[model samples]
Target: MKSLVTAIQQRDGRALQAMSNSVPLQQAQPVREHTAQVFNELFKQLRATFPASMANFKDQEDLNEFKRQWTKAFAENNIRTIDQINAGMKIARQQENPFLPAPGQFIQWCKQGESLAVGLPDEDQLYELYREYCKMRGWREMKWPSNACYWMVTKIYSEMRSKSLTDSEVIKLCAKELRSMTARIKSGETIPAPVKQIPQLYIPTSKERSLEHLASIRKKLNLNPKSI
Candidate 1:
């Protein structure tokens, strides 16, 4: 583990890859403990090296959250090897904001918004923006259906661009609605479903002129307007 940490610190890609391939096929308990130790040391080295940027977690909770998110991200990206770990850490260090929404959390927010019919932006639009965000982050190498980082970054940017509510605001509104519904239920009062707004009909500006032109043409042809 020390050697792996040293190799990672030195950015020795070959050595890291070798170490990753050489991990022992031991009992489940021992393997889990060893993997945890390796990762702990790796994270320590990363924090030591990039204190200002990627490792700027606010507290232990924040760090743990990041770890949870990044662990999922790594697994989803199929980053099982040491070389992949090193590469991911390098990319993370270069990220402008390494902290973003977890995938499950972002999806939950979207689902809640949809269920409440709160006028959330279209899912296709959100996905398009997410792709753009990935490109900007130079994460094109990462697999699609990206991890939580991509989802969170895209959600933040889309909300900002559209002047939409933040996740916290949405969650608060949903909570309030739920509480109100619960109260009504306990009081034996009727609870109404949320109303869906009717979309406005579209009228073309040239419709009247086109109709008049068609009438004139019909008259020139001596056709009965009503019968035609």
Candidate 2:
């Protein structure tokens, strides 16, 4: 059951397709269906991951019984979605041993995944994306992971633009911001819509315009009451 799982993209020495977008998992596709499909996929992946540990289940009957029990236990623990299953597998892979985990222990892993159920990439992944966002800020068509990500990175970039900082310094600030945003999202707060960029009103100073130009509009001192 032990594997090295980092929620970052598979590239750049990370694991967990949790950040699957070219920008977020299995390439960033979310497993929203909480059904047998999810459970079956979880079993298949876990079996592949822990072939040695799960080798004891040599027959279909044994595997079926294991699935039945696990499904019931998972339901009791509210592990209804594949997102939670993916997270649980992530936790499972990070362990040091190859032994299969107890149902209770696996459930704990599933709980940890719940924290990630907001469907946002982990901090480090977002930081990497933020770096790319900075590099490609000039590109008119860049695919952002989500509106929340676009919003977060845009704010981060704006805040950092004036600072003379290194990657470490930037990541420190970015991580904090990412955490706050992730927490808000996990708490069911929707990312507020991006505000439209209001154009700056070009108001010329009194000196920028000639007094002659301003004086062109003459005002009459008295109204012509009798004239049409």
Candidate 3:
């Protein structure tokens, strides 16, 4: 039991798989239920240990290995309740770096429109550019509020800044690049790889911009009283 907990803590898929395989299956209904519950908690802990991209395995072999280990752990533990299986997982999570952004923080960052650009290419415009880029890559149905999409916009902005391109020129060049990349991918000549690092955008917070806009409106109203 201690070894199994340690395996889970280490995220050792192979060890967990071996331990699970060592356990003999019980035909009892309560035993099956308990095993199922343990499996769920084990998977939840494993999933939480990594980012969504890692959790969602791309290779079939990797996915199968995880599943095999997950099942084996459940059988060996014979854990009856969700809480029992989750206790060790909770402890493991507590040992993780607290300063790292939580899942909610990542989502909040997306909502806040954080970027690495010096100026120009606002959040809305960036989102539109991301949409176009995705469409070019045959992901026309893809939406924003995703790290990948955000990174794409930032990469484009970075390129624009490095080249000192105007907004219009950036748009034109990005469109052309997307088309070329899409063509390569469709032809099986290249793999789709977007920027991995997050970019710093120069855009201000929505609140700050709103206040400035309101101040401008007031100034205009004061200049032309009848326009109010």
Candidate 4:
């Protein structure tokens, strides 16, 4: 029964269904009902987590279209194992590739987007969640972590790379450079030249720029910048 909870947590509905089938008919009925309830709750949490995206598909037709595809994929597929089911669910939940930021730019994303905390916890925390989920399923840890785990590792590496210049050793080296530069200036010696800035050319058009004019121009070009 606890395995069903784990399967649900892992979004392995097919695994849950398989586990449910293994139980006595009477037992399976109640378990299936409970699993279904849990699945609904998970979906509600997902919607809450991504309210902005969900809002875009608030219309019945769009919502139904999404549900229809989801249902058809789950129904038509024969998921033979727990892992396979897990993989399928992962594919379904895959978000459009989000823009990644450099360590210096991360602060800007936090300020600009609601997705700031989407992957709040580090990879270790998520791996712990996976362990707990697997334990509840009465399953032993696998010899190797799944591709999802590897994905987490990759994210951690990306974060580490982004912060490379801020590492203690690198920072110390930068401090040395600054000191060297300062000493040269103090000694009345010539310092290294600074980076040159290129001024951008700003050309103003004669046409008035307004919402009305923009709309007219867009209509003429048959282009919708908003769609981009």
TM-score of 3: 0.26
TM-score of each: 0.25, 0.40, 0.26, 0.21
The residue pairs found clashing in candidate 2 are 3-93, 17-25, 19-24, 20-24, 20-25, 20-27, 20-28, 21-24, 25-28
Candidate 2 displacement at residue 78 in angstroms: 22
Q: Candidate 1 lDDT, tens digit per residue, 104-205? A: 443333233332332223344433545465466432333323233233444455554577666555444434443344334445655343233355676656
CA lDDT, candidate 3, residue 84 = 43
C-alpha lDDT score of every prediction, in listed order:
0.50, 0.69, 0.53, 0.43
Give the alpha carbon lDDT tens digit for every residue of 92-164 in model 3. 4554553323333332222222222112243455547654754554323334444434445656766766888
Greater TM-score among 1 and 2 belongs to: 2
* Structural RMSD, model 3: 22.5
TM-score of 1: 0.25
The regions of model 3 sitting more than 4 angstroms off are: 1-30, 97-228
- Per-residue C-alpha lDDT of model 4 across residues 94-124, encoded as one tens digit per residue: 5453332222232222221211122222323
Model 4 error, position 216 (Å): 99
Clashing pairs in 4: none
The candidate scoring highest on TM-score is 2
